[model samples]
Target: MMTPDEMMTLVTENALEYGPKLIAAIAIWIIGSWVIKLLVSGLNKVMDKGKVDPSLKPFLCSISGIVLKVMLGITVLGMLSIEMTSFVALLAAAGLAVGMALSGTLQNFAGGVMILLFKPFKVGDFIDAQGYMGTIKEIQIFNTILKTADNKTIIIPNGGLSTGSMVNFSTESTRRVDWTIGVAYGDDLDKARAVIKQLCDADERIFKDPAVVIVVSALADSSVNFAVRAWVKAPDYWGVFFDMNENVYKTFSKEGLNIPFPQMDVHLHK
Candidate 1:
């Protein structure tokens, strides 16, 4: 559309205008990247000195690096003299859309952060929460993994886990194991109490300081119920519970203590 000389002149002018900016942009990018690396390294050291949780360190570093890289990108764009107003506006819009779409995911991410910081439960602690009971295996960015007693693995999202109610059985060193023992209405109360006391004393896991509590809780139609409660180390809870039940059953039989069962008489008239 134009003479060759004119076209050449126009091209030269355009190159003169943008050439330096392009080179400067590239140099800035390279230098900014190196600076970002140094900053991130320093941040890691600071976190280590602060004794931040091991699981949280890498996550913090990753987020810091991403934010720094994004800021570097903006600086490079400015060096190129590219208009940032529209670009920033478009970026904001896109980010808003993406954020809306990933609302639940974002909640999980926040929840994970809260949990790592607050430390409601750590790995290997036994917990009952969200209708599942298992030992915590790993706490990840968006999920908490659990290993069940039968060796099954469970994955629960952090959103509900962080906010919901949880029972950490391993939090306390001692736990109370409760049992309801019943004897026949006519059974010897003193003998039953002595026998139950002996059984509890035989188990070394049971605590002596708190002492054992055995009381006649209820007298139902079929039997007199004994509310037997004992304190034992948390790790020995289930073992002591099952063993005591078995021993009580066998000992009561050997001692001729009758464990009453519900019975009813039915009559028919012709």
Candidate 2:
């Protein structure tokens, strides 16, 4: 209903009022985006310098970038005079719903964070947890991947892994190998002990500082058990264990030591 000239004047007035705000909003968006990129890059450098695990670095960088961009988006929305209170409330409600629906997933995420921070175990380390034993192949946000000795792949949820007890075999540089050797009760106990000691001493992989222990641990009905304990490098544990076992068997056989087996004699009376 307004005249043409009046319409033109109104449009002019509105443009003059809004033009600077629009330009300022655009400038803020551009500057904010650049700043966010810089911050993300700087964060990556800092994490690298701090020696963050290789598996965690990419995940952390991605999360930081997303958070910064989201904050930037909210700021830009505010600059454009969009109603933020309702939007924020909607976001909170949506987040609450998602969180409730994915409670277990959130726990896994938290567990992942704890793992990255505390470093209970790393990739390639053998660990036993949650009734499974394997070498750690990959550590993800939700689960950890393991490769078993038989080449089976297992995926364990991080939540359970974080809470459960874990034995990391590779944590220490050295580990003790324990073994029990049994000989017939009729065998010469002193001669058997001497041969066992000789076998352990000749093995180059066994550590000598702690000294190998060969002791008569138990005397059973069928045989006498000798407990053999030795220390070896963590990596050398399996090799030394198998080697010593074979060597002891061969040496005992050549030395005429009798290895025992369980035997039961049954007599029937008619």
How many steric clashes between backbone atoms does each model show? 0, 0
Model 1, C-alpha of 35: deviation from truth (Å): 7.3
- For each candidate in turn, the TM-score is 0.79, 0.82
For model 2, state the Cα shift of residue 125 in Å: 2.1
Which parts of model 1 are misplaced by more than 4 Å?
Answer: 1-39, 49-51, 72-82, 267-270
lDDT of 2 by residue, 1-270 (tens): 999999999999988988777888889889988988898889889988988877788888889889888888888778877889998899999999999999999999889888876889999999999999999999987899999999999999999999999999999999999999999988999999999888888888888989999999999888999999999999999998898889888888899999888999999999
For 122-172, candidate 1 gives per-residue lDDT tens digits of: 888999999999999999989999999999999999999999999999999
What lDDT would candidate 1 get against the real structure?
Answer: 0.93
Worst 10 residues of 1 by lDDT: 47-56
Clashing residue pairs, backbone N/CA/C < 3 A, model 2: none
